[model samples]
Target chain A: MGLYFVAKRFGVFLVIVWLAATLNFFLPRLSGDDPVANKLMEQASLGGYAQAGIAEMVKVYNQHFGLDKPLLTQYLNYVGNVAHGDLNYSIANYPRTVVDMIAEALPWTVGLLGMTTLVSFALGTFLGALLAWPGAPRWLQWFMPPLWALHAIPFFLLGLVLMWLLAFQFQILPIFGGHSPGAKVGLTVGFVLDVLRHAVLPSLSIVLVSVGGWALAMRGMMVTTMGEDYVTFAEAKGLRSLTIFMRYCMRNAILPQTTALALALGQILSGAVLVEVIFGYPGIGALLFQAIQENDFFVIQGVVFTVIVGLGFATFLLDILYPWLDPRITYRRS
Target chain B: MSETILRVERLRVAYDHPRGVVRAVDDVSFSLRPHERFGLAGESGSGKSTMALAILRMIKRPGRIEGGEVWLGDTALSGLDTDRMRALRLAGIAMVPQGSMNSLNPVVRIRDQIGDALADHGVGLKGRALAERVRDLLAQVGLPPDVARKYPHELSGGMKQRACIAIAICLRPKVIIADEPTSALDVVVQKQVMQTLGRVQQDLGAAIILVGHDMGLMAQFVDRLGIMYAGRLVEVAPIRDIITAPRHPYTRMLIESLPSLEQRGGLRGIPGLAPLLRELPPGCAFHPRCPAATERCRSEKPAVRAMGEDATVACHLA
Candidate 1:
């Protein structure tokens, strides 16, 4: 909560990001697969080129990308380049830089995943709180079975079902891609509407499958919090039912839910991988999927590095905000 | 007494168990005069706390006020609707709570907690006025004004209990139920908190029902004491008369069980445990443990009979 505490938390964040970057640099190399050689061999096999000069071509390409350097030297250079915000070139998409690709794809992922995560969290938390509340309507109990059923189904499977029903059978929403195939890419109302329409299916699947989890966790917390003595005292104080429900019960119960929200938000880049792939939305999840399939090492490293930084930053913000949420958590040493 | 401030007649609180209905507080009756300090003392599971909660119509689900009437002045609390009952609480009657450690919301500040009770009861105090009222309430409970900014955890156990008392007296209800209010504090702090409660009660002229098991504290603090056993009140008498001449066998044994400094000897304990409400003896609930229980006591329930001035005992021999 203090400047010193914030500085200390930022220090921890830097250390975590550095460690993640190092892991990113080493993990792909540890896979022991020569991506460059594999690409050239596949091209040669397809084009019916002689295999004799392929070794020479591989050597030339390795030198060009500095892969021919010693492992330690390559690591040092990678770290130095990362410090300068250069993520190197993508092997699959040869001339495009990883940073450029990420910049182009990051907004779509953040917009869709971020908005959906918040919406589901708020909806699920409120519903869950109501479910545990004795004063809530009896009809709210009927939602339990259906919510659990939706939670049990995977988002990607739900995505496919929705696509089959709404997109294929009913022909109501778009089937795939982030926008219309040849629409003019601008900030026009038509362009934004197309993007939103495309986002609907993926967002729905994500929210539906994930809301149950949030609701279940929140309900459990609410039940426990409701049993707390403070809640009874609040009622004894003659507070309005709504006041006791929100300020006394839901307020305490929502603390752990906020923690979960932070973790969920941090994982937003990776969480939508399957859903994005299913819907063919032009988000980071889809880009990461493609990168993984094509063995694009630089792009994969960049995506993973971004996720680590995002998570560290999120937890950092939580640390700063936690004292405000629960006053007992003080930064000053006793 | 000019007139009773609060009267509870034949209050029955029962819990619906799978096997049978458990009468936690069965046909218990008592009354408190204005500015009176009445104590309800009994062993664990003796329905003291249950009756206290029943008085406020706060018996939770699975347990309910099966039949009874709690009258505060001209209003019958038992017949009031939910909204009316809620509004009456903390203004008509308030509770000091049994568990002070968790009675105050841990996440909220003391100022807001006290302010909440005031604002809910239509005090209409805001900003500087609210803060001033909170600080005054805290000071009345012997707490520092700075305690208003602190959370429950920041304060000590006794301090938390004082804060609870502060909230209870914010609207100066006619009746204040301090249910085992000091059960969690050290002996030293317990005395201080009780003294604070006494001062606040005198200032408000509110009748208090101090529910606790500490007979020594009860003898010192309460003007009158009621003994409960197996969901029933066995005796109700003035503190001095009960201490000097306890008519009911259970009351006499409970008084004898208290460690006395002048009589240095082995601690005296009652012969048997308090009876379970679900399977109590047909006649007197305490007959099983009564040294002088007779055939009449074992077969017929004794009605509360009048004793010498202002005392009542439900013992056939008495």
Candidate 2:
């Protein structure tokens, strides 16, 4: 059943990616400048060519970049390149393949953002369940207002404050970067420790700024689940309060959040571009930002395609797993 | 006389409302005998459910028993803490709640829920023995043995009610309280559920307290009947007397309001709603709505008076 579902969703996923790639090929041309014209403008800006020389330059550039081919033939070649795991060179920046550039930066963003989100989700959900218990302590209820205040604060501002206080004032840790200046990259424990040390400040900031939202969301889920008749029935059946909390309430309360998590998974790969820029993390978000500024169309297309495919896969996996986690759900093909 | 299993004496349950203390159950009392089916018949807001919860100490915030001793055999249930009360409840005295269709967890199989109650008491029954016992319970409730393997959602409304009954009786408790167990089912299904209850009570010989608004059904099944009007027990008598020789005007009206099986239409419902607990009238709560109400009935609340044949009526005329 699981294999069949995965195969079916994969078919749909491929069709969606194909449509998106087709759009990518046509969309840049709609901006009203051919690659030959762009090349001509560059030569004119450098003041190195007269009109006749610029025309010769344009012809050479067009032939080299395959802009001389028919539109349909160029589109087919682009699709074939994508199929062979070949993301061509960035158009306006460094001549690195878009694939290699993204691969180099992908790990830093995923490691930082993924770790923060998982930790925050766990802590927030546990505390929310505790607070929502019927006879929960007053202090926990009192804790909610401050958490809400933190939640209302913007993530960027929170990251700035943490960087100033913990890094600048205390001189406790490095403020930015994926690793310390002298650190080497390898499978060694020393390299891993260096990466962890550098990741601590920005990751902690992200977790603190985001944890309150999840805590508040989970508290709401708990409050709603607490009122469900099954919870009451579980209580009436004489299951211990702790067992009821863990088994009955949490199991159901966590379900709606699962979809949110699936949606967030693709976005996590991009990370916070602003935060990464502020902290100098070598991640996809920073590269994407640079790529946007330079109009690196090939790299941008590759990044967008990867993010979309990641989202589709995450949602597909979640949909397949939901029925196992919650027996109330059953998969039906339309 | 059968041995008395539970005695609720001078029970007064009140809630702290915005308008002061609203007495939801006012000076109501009754005793249940072993194997006797005592039915409390009243419309919504009559405090029938409140009285049952009070017996189990299941009433939480806002609602409280102001004056009462709920005696299960010799042990006072009302004074016990929540842990002990929960232990006694369902293991010693269980309730088959209203809306039985929604009572069971839709995700869980029927056998697991029944096993859960048994497991709560630190009892272990597993493998063939567990399956056999669940099958026996299913058969006892007139359900197919394989029905235990199905989820509650797969079952019909009446089947869910029977599943509820099966779970309730799994402990073999001394008292079983069923609140409006058949209200949501079809006529034929209602008969089957009620008959299943009768059969379970007979087989277990446990004291049964059946709460319902249907007077005719209550008359047919219950050995004793207590009629509640506006949270007070206005009359208690044999089912025959309550149905044929009702003393309180409220009881009489309630009985007359129900249609006989032969009567096709025009069942006269009670003219007014049950008195709101928050702002009850100064005298008898039912006086404004009672057809035979006198001047004194609107001026002073009546007290319970013993009639012959072990019956009691709370009315000025009586």
Instruction: Give per-candidate clash totals.
Output: 0, 0
Query: Which stretches of model 1 miss by more than 4 angstroms?
Result: A48-57
Query: Candidate 1: deviation at residue B169, Å?
Result: 0.7
The digit string of per-residue lDDT tens for model 1 on B1-318 reads: 358989888999999999899999988888889999999999999999999888888899899889979999988986789999999999989999984449999999999998888877788788999999998999999999999999999988999999999999999899999999998788999999999999999999999999999999999999999999888898999999999999999999999999999999899999878777889898888889999989998999999876765678898988
Pairs of colliding residues, candidate 2: none
lDDT of 2 by residue, A138-223 (tens): 88888777776877887778888988998899978878788887777887998888788788887877777777777778879998
TM-score of each: 0.97, 0.92
Worst 10 residues of 2 chain A by lDDT: A34-43
Residue A263 C-alpha lDDT in model 2:
72
Tens-digit per-residue lDDT, A238-262, candidate 1: 9989889999999999999999999
Docking class of 2: acceptable
The collision pairs in model 1 are none
Provide the TM-score of chain A alone for each candidate, in the order shown: 0.95, 0.89
